[model samples]
Target: MMKFIGEAMNETMKRNFSECPPFFTPFGDTHKCISLFTPIKVSWFEARMFCESMTGNLAILDDINTYIQLLKYIEEKVCNCVNSKINKQCEDNERKLMPRFTGDAETCLSILEENFYYFSDEWCTVKLSPLCMTNKI
Candidate 1:
């Protein structure tokens, strides 16, 4: 039964990709496809695992230009004021409010719309939706 279910899921994925790829949005000139998972909230670690399951990873905005592009895309496409926290791979000096990732091993990076869409540090166990990106898609 599990094998059947897996096969069905694979078929569905193939069909869906043929119609509209999961990561259809082109992220700038980087040739990466990005998609925001908004339906369910999970911990930062769980979010990363989920993205990995989809053959992607949690978005890492390493540069200001990429950050701005993603911010604009989220604002225009997937803005949900009530649930605005999205998991991300955080680095130091990425945003004004971004905490030093090296300071706390238990903390993870996230983008919060309530915080003016700036990067913020939160416990890795905190629940948030994932912003997944993939180069192969």
Candidate 2:
């Protein structure tokens, strides 16, 4: 489902090299000044491949600010260009593709680790219930 939403919506802008991250430093300066991208609904692996081919890797989400910034940057060129609105709409658009929040009862299995306490539990919420995601049905 490589739906090219941005291009379909007639939202294409020149890429801003100054906005490029330091890791892509070399290409940004040597490459085109315009950095317009087509946001397609690609599977995780496809997305990784597309990004690697075009720029680098699938953008990593470390913090909410960066996430919001990128969403705004993409949406603004497409819509009113507001980061907040873009974030909200983008979230809504993506949510349609997400699986249910709860894990499947029988199919879900937990790994019996040697030490549960040793698990850092990076993104776990206050409760484990929020973590199990439903499949795309």
Candidate 3:
């Protein structure tokens, strides 16, 4: 089925790009890899294109549970980066989660400071890290 294909693709991706850790969650049968942020900030369109180049797309919170899980994942990842004894890379990259570009026409989703989900139909012009996702192939 598609899940098997997605898993195979993910395995291949992990083998090829070991540096970027993909996020996986049992919610919604999510076996996708997500790039929380790109090395450089880019516009929403550019961010979507970048993800597409990687055989992925802009992440979408299909439901409330998925959104909750995604928020938790981001928080855990940030905490780990902060606790990591590695270089200052984590501290340097620590930033508010950008209101990610969703597939919804013109509307984007943003997690507020208190971990609440909000959406707007207005266009976003600011450059920020893109949250990308590779769904079931």
Highest lDDT against the true fold, candidate:
1
**Candidate 1 local lDDT, 2-112, one digit each (tens):** 543354356447653533345445566786767665544777778878777877777878789988888777766554432434312222122222212323888887777
**Candidate 1, poorest ten consecutive residues by summed lDDT:** 90-99
The sequence of per-residue lDDT tens digits that candidate 3 reaches over residues 1-137 is 35434644665566534333333222234665565652446667777786777667777777787777777776676546667665245565424344456556665555433444344333555565666776543
Best by TM-score: 1
Model 2 per-residue lDDT tens digits across residues 30-110 = 221112232343333343454456445444333555435434533444334224543344333322111111243322111
lDDT scores in order: 0.62, 0.30, 0.56
Model 1 pairs whose backbones collide: none
* lDDT ranking from best candidate downward: 1, 3, 2
Poorest 10 consecutive residues by lDDT, candidate 3:
19-28
Q: Which of 1 and 2 is ahead in lDDT? A: 1
Clashing pairs in 3: none
Could you give me the TM-score of model 2 versus the true structure?
A: 0.34
